[model samples]
Target: MNEITERDLLDFALLTDFESFLKHSMLTLNPGMPFLPNWHIRAIAYQLERVRRGEINRLIINMPPRHLKSITVSVAFPAFVLGHDPRQRIFSISYGSELSLKHARDFRSIVESPWYARAFSQMRLSRSLDDEATTTLKGFRKATSVGGVLTGLGGNMIILDDPQKPVDAQSKVRRDSLNQWFSNTLVSRLDNKETGAIIVVTQRVHMDDLSGHLMGSSDQWEVLSLPAIAEVDEQVPIGDDEFHTRRAGTALHPEHESLETLRGLQKDLGSYDFGAQYQQAPIPEGGATVLRNWLCWYDRPPERTTKTKVLLSIDAASKDGPQNSYSAFSAWQVQDGHYYLLNMERGRYNFPQLRDKALALAQRYEPTLIVIEDASAGIALAQELRSMGRHRVKAVPVERDKETRLFIQTSKFEAGHVHFPKDAPFIPDLLAELLAFPHGKHDDQVDSMSQALAHKFSGYTLDNLH
Candidate 1:
């Protein structure tokens, strides 16, 4: 550490305000005052300095949850800025009054603290808390909860802190309302002057939140998005390695000396959550269907045997012609609730080609039954196959909504009741569908398979036709 000069101390003191002036005089002035200026805070301070210089219009910090973002932005940092420019107007808003009040209280505490008094001995504060959105400070108006349009001069400084609550963030309706508030109420208040807005928050919902709005704009905003889990898809590991790589490329790279030390953080926290919460990586959506941990679990296939009772389930697509859908055939063995998916055939085959394949499979397996979803051209295919001496063919229409069927199947999967061969042909597809169900990404194969399984297990065949 080098010797501290009076000029440096005075400049640092000036950045904060008269409160800072008094605090420096009291020998309590330091980087780690009320809150430590961590790397993120330091980076934010640099940006805030730009705000002071009129270089940038907005600075948005979109960090993950529980990362000291609120304390830095809403409380200590804001106080520090006010200490420097007493006339600076800041309008801070959150989703609810309680949250807004909480941040306001934090600001009040920092201002009222003994250290703050010692920092700025002559700093004056308004005793009356204005019920109105605008409060007069030294003849300058500082607005609170004022809509963007209301700020006619544009916001000299606006702090949008955690605009969406955890619940509201997830609720589509509530999210839309909050987004509307930002677009209509908050943003409309900005004046032509260099309006400084610093947004610090943990993302609870989709990217289209406040941060999402600022994504493309370059002149008015700068976004710092750090998700809990960073995996884009199946190919990349979105956890620790990727996290360090991002940090290394950032301005804060020099602050962290060793990646190993960062990795050691796992000792204090569990890997699963640590990877997500701190690393800003996404966790695989796991719930009732297949256990998240059991996604990789499966039973090894038994040796091929002629004695096993085999059957095939066909989920036929539209016969109105090949509109890009395939005639999916899944071969399985029925034993209790578990159906071991064996072979799968999926392609855009014509009526004759599909008929021949279905017959070939029936003969090859010597199936105890051949269940098929009776819709589109499935009825015709079944009739034609039967006329060709394939009496095992049965047409089964779906009974209820696909969602309802998935719920039943998923319940079975969660209970560890569903069994499948280790070498199951469509196991990957099956698991993917199982996990992706209700999410509505890939349910076609599962929909077909469900129709066949419902018919086979429920003992409702074509013979039960009434």
Candidate 2:
């Protein structure tokens, strides 16, 4: 029997543990600096495990730039995979030849280091291999650009990092070319028909980018979307059995980039670029759907004496199931031909909760009229509120669809009439829904705003108040 040395045990740990390999290999790349593992790094480690186990064949990861996406996916993962199985073929693709070659060199450096050699002594680069853009350690690893020719290359695992350059993402011609190469050329280079794995890591650049196209066209791929800041509560799967839930407003990497710094960057980038680059939303900010310049921000409402009328507008949810829509309500103070948005409350609730919320708002605001859309639960809510005789509730029959109503209100927003409080916690939610408009996931906020606008323009006077 042969005895294993201390070096062999250290090598065994590196081969079996992905995170440990990543931390130890950091010095080879960035010599004296510390390697900090963020939440996203831990999450990426879990995903790589799934790939190694063959649990997921096709995976897509979306995250903002400068978040160590390339380091984790293109550099560390390939080295770790190749360490365990020296003969495993890895093909990495990127936006340009230079970037692709850099990754190849980095991977080679990690694997050729003394530390890695001790751990995986069996894995060695072939003597005849060229250490350039297309390095081949005798079928062990290779890297190439997106559109590069691959006449006789095949890979057991493929990693595509930032396939689209941000500047050219909007060009239809460039986007189509990349998509074609991926579908036709890349998919055929997989060594195995049933078990080969492919991973895509990129920040969303357009609605027609590769990530968007794949997610829209098919459901075969498992997607892991990590936005720079948490826009929604998400339980992101780190590994097969572990998950991390990021609450809304939480930064993905707070130590590296503070929440305050990220918020400043968002403001500087504006809504359009920020949505695509940071939020993983490709839609332009305040485009044809909504006017960005028309959004007016106020420190507070006008003087108490300047307020002539107070009203509440409700858009109720139709069902009470788990998938039930949210019931949204907007409180407004109308004065001087302008509607000052005072408060907005939106949530998924049953009849009892909805009644209690509406009653509570009425008690606090003392609104003269409560405008409710006469549809589904709206009718019942309005009737019940009126039956209490505490507030005047008017059921307005909505003649047009939500889109039409929003379009009508677009002119008001364009004219800079609709105003919102600047520092409210609900401001971001309201803006996200308003800017995304008809394409957004939730329209309850839009419907409630439209209802309020409909009442403002209805020519109802103070004398006619019930």
Candidate 3:
């Protein structure tokens, strides 16, 4: 391939009229848009195309604020999707009717624009249906003003556009209502076939706020996170050192002028708030029962070398072999004021599979005491483990609420006592749910941890004493 001349590049940039129209329309809304596509937008487009081809059913885009993310994904992108598939059903929702209507209007404007006419001459915007929001000749239908109007629709592309506003997103009641609306109303409207749902919003609140509820789910959900500051190493699961380094570098880089200004605006707001808004991290207070600063201050435990007394806690699944509960088996070595979270087994599993794992943990870690929560439908499985000659198999009952237990353990984690492996697979969910206390679901890991820790920290020595 020959190297294209600067003149040719510039000409091509201009000659790409349809692309220019798209860029110009976007510029009209956000003039200072970044030169390149952010990761979240790219991911959304990729998923949207896949859905158009009937690849995936659902997706969730949870990004930090002030990145011009919503306009790219929610407002303008729907029209773009319609360009590809005219018959697609699109429904967009926001916190309030007014905001939802505004997004719908934006979509209508794009479809009704002169540029739209010039680019796609045959296409025409459809009249608004009383039940349906709006439709276009491209066979794409869109609706913005919705609160509880998602019943009876099928094959609809549900766009939950910031269902919780900044203020409402922070409120537990408001978050619960929106989640309920999505579940009871919006999600119910989909046909028997796989439905497409897109949740695009700035990270205004907790992980469990809305996006967190959908984690580890196979019902067609993917979280597309884009932080304003690009981390140093730029890996998939970016680490702290590289994250901070890259964030600082992005703030100082001259080409990223607007991002630097955004950083300054964040500084004006406050660092923790900035972290929540722009870093795609969870809100410190919104469903965050445990303080992240305190958690970050604590360090991971040193790898075990010599023989150590260990307590293993298991939270078993209740229903399906794969879709039921996540079977998490965590081992803790309570010595020298350190709680080492040794191994974790989390995924869909049956009794036989879970039994095999229990045996494996016993053989591998040789735990002194085994604590399995005698909750959920698999209580008899605990007895089966004991019947199999698993030494020190203790089935402990978890009677306390998750919040109370988490509150008890939060103090320990803050005191630099609870240590988890940096690579523990369940660590992310554990930390996320622990911080996002009452609101987050699947408190199994935290519950098991709290039970084991409560047992240890309270100076209880008898195995299976609870």
Candidate 4:
């Protein structure tokens, strides 16, 4: 046997630690580019190590595009994981065949290189026609796209790199189909359900995209959300008891993107897209439809006078289940053609509970007119109230979608006609749903607000904010 040398010792080091392997193999896949040390890289490597040891079964990594996510996650990771455990089968997937093949090629290149052999000297390869590299140990790394299958096989570790193209994720039908594939087909491909690990590295496409769906799964996912710019302070753990302090307003990887550059991208991509893709928040600050600049704050609405038109708009929950949407109603007082929100209440309730809650609140606020969406429980509530000789209750049938209704009232919000209480408990939830709009999960508040605006001001005209 050959005596151990300095090079041999170095190879052992590379084989043992994820950071060592990742740092050294940076040049193995991409020959020319120098590795600029980023905190996110270390953080990701640490998390992957945890995954390998079965510490984390589910990992969702959300970062901005072109931020070394593809290189580190798809290319280097498969090579590194298989190096330590050559028997570990890896199924790598991407949004398209081209991307999946590209990752397969990169992983194959790294595993075939002299550096990889030095570290994993026992691991052997096959010069195969398929987009795969098999080890002598009977394990392989195979690449496939979103709908592509592995055919009656499963992997120890599955990596989904950009599961959906940004545009495709916007379509509800496409998104739902992808979600079904993930929840049904892909999930069933785990070699060992209890011990297998799933790593999903993607940019946030929509609020209901693959990442969002996985987040709601029973198996909890440790989300590493490194936005292009930090929205809040966070301590991203890189190693045991070691952390990278990410300050608010600071860039995630300054070497790759400066804060000013990210701002420029926001302008280029628009707030909604930039917010989802880069910011990872999926909604912009200062609101999307109802701009915060136009939001008028109030301690209280002007005392109810004969001129004030009290409108109670209830957007009932579609059903009475814990998982279903919350039945929400917002009370607004219109005075001098301006709508000031008085109060809002929302909760998961059946018909009787919802009716009682509405009537109790209505007793206190004493609304002159009430508008409810003409669907689900809203229809029944409107009928019951009308049967009680409450002719003020109007069940408005909606021909347009939720987004269209909100968009129609965009002018009213921008014209500074809508006002929200400064310190109301429900204000945060209301504004969050309003700003998140069509993308957010719960649009009950948005429905209520829009319904009130359409019914009360159908005959009125206001000057646009010019």
Q: Which stretches of model 4 miss by more than 4 angstroms?
A: 1-6, 284-434, 437-466
RMSD in Å for candidate 1, one decimal? 13.9
**Residues 1-466, model 4: lDDT tens digits:** 9999999888888877776787777787667988888889899989888898889899999989988888788888888877777788988999999988887877777777887887787777754435788887888888899989667988888999999999998789999999999888888899888889899999998877898888866558999988887654678899989998887668888877887787777766755787789877676445666776777888878887778788889999867765577788888899898899988888779999989888887787888777788888888998887777643677788889888898999888888888888767566446656777675556877888889888754443222100
Q: What is the Cα-based lDDT of residue 430 in candidate 2? A: 79
Ranking under TM-score, best-scoring first?
2, 4, 3, 1
Q: After superposition, how far is residue 230 of candidate 3 from its true place, in Å?
A: 3.7
> lDDT values of the candidates?
0.54, 0.81, 0.60, 0.81
For candidate 1, the per-residue lDDT at 173 reads 72
- Candidate 2: lDDT over CA atoms? 0.81
User: How does model 1 score by TM-score?
Assistant: 0.46
lDDT score for candidate 1 against the true structure: 0.54
CA lDDT, candidate 2, residue 190: 93
Give stretches of model 1 more than 4 Å off.
1-37, 117-123, 130-154, 193-200, 216-220, 227-466
Cα lDDT of model 1 by residue, 1-466, tens digit: 9998886676666554433333332233234544323345444455555655666666766555555566666656556656555656666666556666666766666666675655544444765253212223541223244232354545556677767654454456765676677666666555543454545455534434555545533455755544333222122222223322332212222243233433444334533334333444322345334455543334653455554446688877775242345577777665554565666666567788888888888877777777777787688887777676645677776677878876666555556645565544445335544554555234557666676556544555556631
Clashes of each: 26, 2, 4, 0
Instruction: Give the lDDT of residue 123 in candidate 1.
Output: 49
